[model samples]
Target: MPIKGSSKGIVGRVGSLRGLSTALMLGVALLLVGPVAAEDFPLRDKYASVGVPPVETGELAGSLDAMTVVDARSPYEYETLHIRDAVSIPLASRDFNESVRTLAEESGQPLVFYCNGVTCAVSYKAALKAKKVGVKDARVYDAGVFTWAQTHPEHTVLLGEPLQSTDQLIADEAFKDRLLDEDGFYARIQSSTDPVIVDIRSQDQRQGVSLFQMKDRHVPLTNDNRELGGLVQAAMNEQRPMFFVDATGKQVRWLQYYLDEQGVEEYWFLEGGASKIYEGMGLQ
Candidate 1:
């Protein structure tokens, strides 16, 4: 099993607290390679423990046709951005395994499934599922679409357009600009005359319990994004400052592209998203 990103696990802590600031800076630089580090997301460990191997990003980059690349994320995410020539076969579909089988048989190529990044378990799970269904070679590209897009713009697509320059992709700094902690989110609500909050959680994720007492408008970026389109249009039309929260804050990365593309000027995302907000709320 070859893992590319963060190939080496953290070996050990510093023996002494000497030069701690420099060490901390180096660690921060390493971890920020993605939205979050693999250590923070245990699902990567969970799948790897069960025997799913990750295809190195550079290996895939060197040989794009070595395997049939599959986007294990939702079609919406795929539509927003994806590796050029990668097929979208979201893991949630009823015939996911069957679809993998068809592609494998037709192309006679190994399969590599990838979603958001280290935070996402979909790609790992998708590969495991493919193996269970007897696909010859199934692997994961756990580094995912974001890294791929940034790594090779020539191999990237954004909003149905070939990404001509890396500048077209959103920068980490740009995303950081709109990202807010729980306190910042609360401050925005408290300071606003009429805070237009938005909950982007999926219906199933909400579990029929409103995170914001059903007050915040619910508009998720699902496969069918008509509702989300309406919300974006309204936000653009009204020039309202909307605060958005998702299940785990990862979705907002994808949503931000849409928001920025739509020219929505004022918006903020709740870091750690609805999950953290719930914990902050101290609800049962």
Candidate 2:
């Protein structure tokens, strides 16, 4: 009924229409469901993520799953507040390692060590100790309880009397050149020179072991060494000396090394043990 040219043109148009229909259907199907292709990140793949072998600093910030959070703090501090289910292991105990080994033997979990915070060195020391005792998976949570409290206020934190490191005592200048021995510390206390006395021993020693020699201005350095950040920041705010005092001068020396890394000014320390203070007081 149509001319030859017209019929041929119609057939060609019909064929084009069919091809377009097929292409649309295919596109729609792919859009609805198809395998997603992604380009691989060569650098990330090579590094094996952030928390893998030969590097551990990045690992400590990871989730708490499957980890045994060891609170390397004093028992009284531990009782006040700690991560729920965290095992208390005081750093001052001679049998600290034994306790850790027993805990590991009982539960056999990965260890995450924590104390006061960045300023507190006990947690780092404890982590190093943990690493020595076949707990290859141990790492330090340098933030400690203070950071934890800051970050997780919704969670419960045990409260108790505040503790301060012995270094703070020497920094105060009242306890400068004073012997740190039992007799020396008490004599200074009796003199009421208003010396800031800091006892580095664990809570057990403070309550049960022996009566503190100097009760004047006593600051208890809690197990949560991370909280000591407040002290450091406060010192920085006040432009006060971040000094050191301990049973021996060892802790202050270590603190000096740490403060040096922080670009802190010079910190002082007593040359002899605290006992020399007693002798200086003529009480030794």
Candidate 3:
């Protein structure tokens, strides 16, 4: 299957392979893409010899009582929504080895790692890492949070808060207000003198983008972005309204929570993000 959010052009190009199994199709795509250059693509071959077998969603659902589930996505992704009872231990974290060791010692149960889905390599890498560190039973739930959310929404948890239906989440006023549309964001930038626009897009994404000119600072939104807490502190010290934006606006929700933890009260995120602004301004 075409990766989620892949363009129609890509889908049409891959249409001839519709008869292939999803795993086979993904393998073909990976071959064409060549290695896990992007964060979204998983390094399936990296752990091929690690012997971390794929666990199906159905098996995971049935085996939850006997296994410990670890979310290999970032804490932000975990907090946004995750398989219920799964512990967050981002694969890319410095503390990953320690976390796995702790989890193994604490639970003494089989550990399952999962991120976005089969398309994401985090869980595979995480499982391999765990095995390398002597957690012999580490396994990858190949069908990850995306599949779990679709097939078992009731088993999903959000932000350590009360379990909420998708509709309820949409209707939440607090969640709703965090989003500022292109027009609203433009007006805020133009009129609001106190709030500083914080561009959280990757440095690569920021290149040649006119919106970067409006930003008071640039901090790429990644779990490994060491400058994140410092940036948050700087914004807090200034006590200015903090406006955040990412490539698609989704990542800002994670940063919003980060700001909240840092005691930031005034913040907003661009809805639909820089892409929307580019579209609105008729820029490529």
Query: Which candidate has the highest lDDT of all?
Result: 1
TM-score leaderboard ranking:
1, 3, 2
- Model 3 C-alpha lDDT per residue in residues 145-188, reported as the tens digit of each score: 75576566688764444344544232234545778888887787
Candidate 2 Cα misplacement greater than 4 A, ranges: 1-62, 159-284
| Top candidate by TM-score | 1
TM-score of each: 0.78, 0.40, 0.54
Question: In candidate 2, where is summed lDDT lowest over 10 consecutive residues?
Answer: 19-28
- Determine which window of 10 residues in candidate 3 has minimal summed lDDT: 18-27
Q: Report RMSD for candidate 2.
A: 27.5
Show model 3 residue runs off by greater than 4 Å.
1-49, 162-196, 201-214, 218-250, 253-284
User: Model 1, which residues run further than 4 Å from truth?
Assistant: 1-51, 281-284
Error (Å) of candidate 3 at residue 119 is 2.0
